[model samples]
Target: MARNPAPFAPFEWMIAWRYLRARRAEGGVSVMTWISLIGITLAVFALIATLSVRSGFRSEFVSTILGANAHVTVYDVGRVGQQGQLDRAIADYEGWAQRVAEVPGVTRVAPLIKGQVLISLRDSSSGAEVYGIARDDLKSLPGIAQSDQAAGDLTRLDEGIAIGSGIARAIGAGVGDTVKLTSPNGVKTAFGTSPRVNAYEVVYVFSAGRYDIDRTRVYMPFAEAQAFFNREGVADELEVMVEEPEAVNALTIDILRAAGDRAQVWTWRDSAGGFLRALEVEDNVMFIILSILVLIAAMNIVSGLIMLVKNKGRDIGILRTIGLSEGSIMRVFFICGAFTGLIGTAMGVVLGCLFAIYIDPLFSFVNYVMGGGVWDPSIRGIYRLPAELNLSDVLSAVGLSLGLSFFVTLFPARRAARMNPVEALRYE
Candidate 1:
């Protein structure tokens, strides 16, 4: 019924393929084609690589926070004293810790007394935050209980003190070394309150992976902390771990109920030092900026195809004279642009995925070539760089590359379709 075989038919594909593969002397693809293809590949690769790294960084950051800190923390609102002044502490913290642990989804609990102290080893000194916990309760801590997190004798935690690796480095103190701790909370005597200064053996060293936490944290026995902080019988608060840290928000009501009246609850999402918010903001900014870059690269497709249309003017005139429709001419150029995009995107995806998947070994090689110090744990807040390849990000990149390539190709394509055969042949 019709002379044409329909749009983008086999004949159109054959002509498009011939146009793409023919030599430049035959008025085929120019140098611009290779340039546009390479640009698209490089841009897509950079976008995917950056996304994978951001994902890995977020994953490690959140993991460190959850491992080293409580999913939900329960404390007392404190009671008004006889003088109408408030004195705050979680009274009978052990009892409340047990009660909260009974709630479903709660995995572990520790009744702890927390205080700040100045730790010294000879002339070296550093400030440290101390947690008062029992030897048996050491295993209940999410981060410290891990084999990689703790070194030295965990058994002797009750007999002495456990200091963080950064504190040990700061004061040149090692396990089995004596370190002096001075607390401002002192015993009140008839004369005046005196600062509590005591020397204890550093029996173990631990790393929480978070720079702030590891640099200034230590653990003491519960009884010792109670006495050292001048609250002989009570603990500061109840630290709790749950089966699902993300679901901690839903379980806060049950925790408050279990902890009784005048109890307050907070989750790690709010309490994880404000750095998480900064990281999220950074992630959004990077994605927006990189997406713009991908767009710029896809624009190169317009430049390349425009040049191709000019070079193929004579061939286009001959085809139009032989009765080719304008739509067929446009479809032919459209296929050319799309094919370049497809091959380039494929190459970029493969390279980006491989880089993310084998990041560890690749990182090691980089660190070696740089002669170490590629990543600073103190500065970056993590010991290593990480990457996570997400399928959605890859899909988004592919869609963007192909979409821009096709859209920009239309202008040059329509020009070729509408060319006057007489003028095209007359010029040649």
Candidate 2:
């Protein structure tokens, strides 16, 4: 009759340690096994660290964009069809705007006019996207608006402007310096139209840490934008600053209910369109592609363990004949294979986290060597890469690495378990 194995003690560590020590000088553990263990360890660490860095880049990039742009945008649907009807649309828009402020989750609603415009500064001429924002609500935007200026006077008399650092650099405009703004006006009988020109002094310079926004964003009073475009008492869009960006979908539905057919509510994701879709696709693709490294490592574990099973067959047979059952023999091999995985995974988690934690400094050192790494004193921005580590990312990385390690040992352990003692002991 077979002896009953003690619960939780079937595969004890002391047995595993003795087996490992006895085989250290033997042919069971080959050079290939060591190489495979090292490979798996390195691959798992690299995947975890690489994915963390990528995640950091994605998150920082999104925050930079969201900082410059509002949570949601409300635009006149009719404005898409005709520029002439803008004057008549303001009354209906004003009524709806008031109600939007009263809606739950709605924090602030500000009128905005945006269009492409040409700007000429001295001899420098460049085309830029112009944003006409309400002077009173300017404090709501990031970078330019701050807690201190939330209630400050932001009155735009006529031609005051706030320009992004990139735009200012492109136009060579400084605070109190003037730049010419030009936009297409109504069509004429003989000619298409000429650009309506006006000069505005730069009132403020803002940086939102994104090249796209810092280079192209130009803020002006709504009245000034309407005048420049030859469309008085009209706004191109209504920008909404929500309490939370995640609430945009629900708030958008509620807004559409109020605006009905008059205006279209759009979230930041909608405004960015294909770009946002591409970002999401990129994240998923990168994750799956990077995970292949870990998979390759897991395969290495399997190869190493299979070799161990083959080399240990005779030893396993002798142990089974003496006292150890087939199940215990299997447990011995399982312990060996699992030990490799567990040790590698534990090492990888620590190494990967350390790499992530110091990635910013490492990038800084590289950038310093590149010579173009200097931050402009005037421009308040993060020239260095941003990395925000989340617990979820760490948990997923460690868990996946360990899980892969465990899975890799399963087949080899099963094979070791089912080995025929008679065939294994043929030489003995």
Number of the predicted model whose lDDT against the real structure is largest: 1
Model 1: per-residue Cα lDDT over 281-374, one tens digit each: 9988987887788778778878888888988899899999998999999999998888888888888888889889999999999999999988
Evaluated at residue 315, the lDDT of candidate 1 is: 89
RMSD, every candidate, angstroms: 2.5, 4.6
> TM-score: which candidate is best?
1
User: What are the per-residue Cα lDDT tens digits for candidate 2 across 1-428?
Assistant: 97668632645556665544555567556465566667767876776776786678667766765676878877666543356543324435576778777778888888777778787799987778888777767766665664222221235424488777777778787777888877776334376786577788777777767766767778888777776665576666677878887557878888776655677777887766686678678867876776777777777778877887787788778777777766676676667667777777777777788888898777778778988545452352334565656677767766776777777777887898788888999997
Which sections of candidate 1 miss by over 4 Å?
1-3, 80-85, 147-149, 360-374
Global Cα lDDT for candidate 1: 0.86
Each prediction's TM-score against the native? 0.91, 0.83
